[model samples]
Target: MNDSVNRPADGAPISVVLAGGGTAGHVEPAMAVADALTALHPDVRITALGTARGLETRLVPERGYHLELITPVPLPRKPTGDLVRLPGRVRRAVRQTRHVFDDVAVDVVIGFGGYVALPAYLAARGGVRRRRVPVVIHEANATAGIANKVGARSAQRVLSAVPGSGLKDAEVIGVPVRAAITALDRAAQRAEARAAFGLPDDTPVLLVFGGSQGAASINRAVSAAAGELARSGVAVLHAYGAKNTLDLRTPEPGDPPYVAVPYLNRMDLAYAAADLAICRSGAMTVAEVSAVGLPAVYVPLPIGNGEQRLNALPVVNAGGGLLVDDADLTPRFVAEVADALLTDPPRLSAMTSAAAQVGHRDAAERVAAVALDIALSGRAARGRRR
Candidate 1:
């Protein structure tokens, strides 16, 4: 795709573009791969492609990457008023993204699958510009998103964060998680992790959370059952999300302590302190806990194509986690199931090993290496053509 001089000045950096963003689920993986690329190839020039309206607008820059902004053009799942305008909107986004690719002389384009990714994939495939480049796509959801489904056919390689992602022949590489989590050693940091969260060193701790805004059902159920868990000598570390508030279950004189917070920016500490988790089965959440070898009770969001259930199924099947329907995750269920598992050290230990076995701590590095290799191959092809 580089139509300029046959080669750059000696020692010039190899350029790579990462595309995706909307939620932290998409952004974090892109950033993790960026981090891996920077670490592994010091001479690499990293560029992020995302929409102005996505989390990447702020997060990518904050992480020290140059983010190229484009307009967001969301596709309607069904025929709607938005469908009439989609063609023009998508065309405009593709043009903008194509400009970015040409401007950067991109050697390869890697997409993590989101609204922005569709345009990046198109641009990398040459689109109206007639400048083809190698394309790599990563699907982080258990079910492939529309962008990934469309992009995978044209990609040089397809990667999935979880099993059963519905992408044909896609390699299961796990999610590219935050380095903090992949490096966490719960066994080594157990005491320090508990102390960091003001948790008792000797008691079993159960961690509960939903998504970022918090799941109202989880909050209500877990908050109501906190007193029961405390009475059973089990402590709690609950993240109520920034938008929701927990009706605190006041600890009595002889009860185990309960810690509640509006948000947990330091999930590393939470994962380290937790003996088990009761949380949603978002791809990132599943990947992180599985990487750290933490057992969990997953309550998938009852909305959208039922992908969350698919996300937790592999772990649950592997004996590393349990998937409970959202409607069934009541206070009684939490107590009976979560408590039963937490109290059984032998079961938890086996589950821990099972989870670790399925997780990939080096996923970021592995994905980065794949992208970099394609970039190198693309350059070599260009050299031969010259």
Candidate 2:
């Protein structure tokens, strides 16, 4: 009766397939848990399932994991031609996923609720000649997406970042963020991080960015306030979308510098360098920002079912962050609120503690531990059947 999930009863290495791709929101949590699984058992086999069209094509391989691409089955929200063809697309994707499952001898399927997860869930549930495997689901959004809502039915374990993600029985495990984020020492790294970003060490820095592609509204508002912020002794690091351009003026010799980059590869450094952040409140963003203990003014994307607002509200209510509607995020608002906060050390320090309190730093390891246990149990059950 060994309690270790690192090895099965037969001493075979556990194989896991993570299905969460398309968006950074889905892909990041999956990767975080994948990293955690490997850290727990170095010999464990980990694979990622994604489509050619998703960011996982780049993100998965860069993290040094094997990626299997399958036909994407997009769920249409309304009655359309795509909806009519949904069944056939799902069948094809499921068939392709089943092949990957067999190739890897996957013992467990861990899904993060995206276009890539449904087929993997169905394939693992057993159909036709498919073999059944344990399924674990992690829903990272405040509102569960279509794929996760379906996958939750037969999952061996269901997890979510928040309580009301539409997964009624989901265990609240928090969103899984990378270890680099959870282990960050912002105070210790601040000097090096500011230097890395070509920023002044003594200035209060405001880190602003949308998602990977950047947010147009956020970009416009933040960039427009660059002059006012710099004049007020606040340095600005703005990551406008790659495709978008800003019309900000060059800083005067005595003013705090305004640094604008298209993207941020080292978020750990960015978090270390900033006193305050103005950004979108995606589940992943909220989790990462709070995990690093960085205070933020979260501007929810004004679309969908107000899920982004819901994502930020708990943290905001806890005094870890602020919630600003997209429509209200103008230059004047940035000057009055963001500028005032950046200058207030007492408020920022209080918010930092509150944000850290809301973040689950061990979420990845918790998910990995449970997933491994489920995998081991499945393997032992199969052994008994033989």
Candidate 3:
């Protein structure tokens, strides 16, 4: 994979087309790698491919990149109406994507697997030597998604965030996380970050969240134990979903702050302010938390193919965190677990070090390096052939 991206000549420029996004989990990593590539070589041209319906329509552009639209081809779980239309819809999407590759003159196609990735993968393998392009895939989950499984077959390099992702010959490159997280110095920023959240400077905090929409099960269970956690001498930063009306406001006077807000606009600040975290185990969340060296209690969402549970297993096994079943997340259980960890500084310190050992803060640069090498190698290969 490292054949000739040794460096690019003056006049030659590398262009990339990145594909992913149905949720922040898929979109954010793609954006992070794009950012890393631009940082490494400002002249590198980058474009993105996403479905009209995914979060990419908002996030990709907000991150300052052009996003070409494609039809979403979500694999149906069972025999359904959409399943029948899958073949025709996918064919049209691939046709449209081929035009995008031509329009961009894409040197390499990189994908963080999602509903839109299969089309991008198909377009890159244009059925001819002249049109064929090198492909790289990044799998964000411990258990691979269907799109990634297919993309891996033809990808020049396949990268996985955790082990057991089911991508053949996959290299574990960790997840590409934002620079703010990668460069975070929690100790230096702790005073300011805690103050901004109305928390005391010298105290333990438990940051609880359930991704963008918030987790009702997590919220309900945690909120119920708010008093217990406070009595145990820990501050709480609860990001209730924007639509939630439930209040876990501090009841008794002189209790450590239990700051409950609808959403956390600045996640970096939240991470800087917290000592430990209790959140749903999504791939991105696990990556970010571990990247920051914060220990966590991961409650995997009880849906899908049990991938969420799989995502946290590696860290948990490494002594970096704990895993709790969604069904077992009662108020009593949450309070006892959080209190035990918060009150024990030795355990907290050890876990932080363990998480640091497992986390990959420079993964963005590493994955970007692979993508650039593949692109440069393809260009050199073509030139030699000519």
Candidate 4:
């Protein structure tokens, strides 16, 4: 699919091409950066390149941006018979993106690390010979994913969500969180938020979420430990994800004093209401937790070459949260960590301070500034040539 138009002439609207998909982790950052650009430079035109197979087809358009679909083939983790098809798919995606660049006259390409992002990076480097459009990549996870690894060599600037990933030209700008999360006033909203979420005014609440889709291992462990946590005077708000809720038998009546929901549409309220959090260490999750200054116990997903562990390391090291491996996650362990964090006021306060320290709540604005600069610089160079 191709979505294209001439760049607006008002200050020569920087035509930005964002490529990433497959999950909310990848797509959300791209949107955050796009929103940042729109806020900083109203004339800047943003378009997204993604595959229909990924979540972008739904998410990008839903966010009021143009979505361009391209054919994407999964890269093999290990060499297999399907490996031969990889080259052909890559060629097709590259060709499609080339057409997209030509149609849109894209000035810069920003990639947020995913297989769907590869074509746009290749097109920016190989197909657009005249403009030399700047390519920027943001790696949101600790261990760089395969897409970012390939995109890095050609990227003009690399921005990392976590620090010291051994990537050159990398800046630790923190992951871009949604605008709503950044706008919250923790001290001002805490009391009212607690009441809104149906928790006692003074009860210490622990917010638990696996992710948008949720993690079964985390959900199971937290459910089993709910009673223990409640007995310690900690209230629980758990989002079990829609898919996992069916298999999770309901707690017996009058058991754990907690609220269980499949999803949370109002994360601002949830964050404001919580005293602490237990969550997966996805890049977006880390940013949101840090943005809101909530102490956390992070359980990184045990998959994809331990990428989640790498994402959580910075926050864990900074004393913002504790990282526990999935192998180590158990009902007893979950209860113990939750109890300790919620009950210890001094420790919880320290963690919140540390989290706030590392969080760059204005990262989206910074990213947008870079995008606008690249676009304006490209335009100036073109004018000089003419």
Better of 1 and 4 by lDDT: 1
C-alpha-based local distance difference test score of model 4: 0.82
Across 1-386, the per-residue lDDT of candidate 1 in tens digits comes to 22222234344577888988788889999999999988877768888988878889888999999998887878789999899998888899899988888788788888998778888887777745386888889988989988998989989999988767888889999999879999999989889889988889999999998977789999999888877787678999999888887897557897877888988988998999999999999988888989999999999999999989988888889999988999998888878876798889999999999999888798898888888777777676777888
- Between candidates 1 and 4, the TM-score winner: 1
**Residues 147-203, model 4: lDDT tens digits:** 888888988789988776657779989888779888888878888887777878777
Worst 10 residues of 2 by lDDT: 1-10
Worst 10 residues of 3 by lDDT: 1-10
Candidate 2 residue-wise lDDT at 243: 86
Model 4 TM-score, all chains together: 0.92
| Cα lDDT, all candidates | 0.86, 0.91, 0.89, 0.82
lDDT of 1: 0.86
Off by over 4 Å in 1: 1-10, 127-129
Q: What's the TM-score of each model vs. the native? A: 0.95, 0.98, 0.96, 0.92
The positional error of residue 47 in candidate 1, measured at the CA in angstroms, is: 1.2
Clashes of each: 0, 0, 0, 0
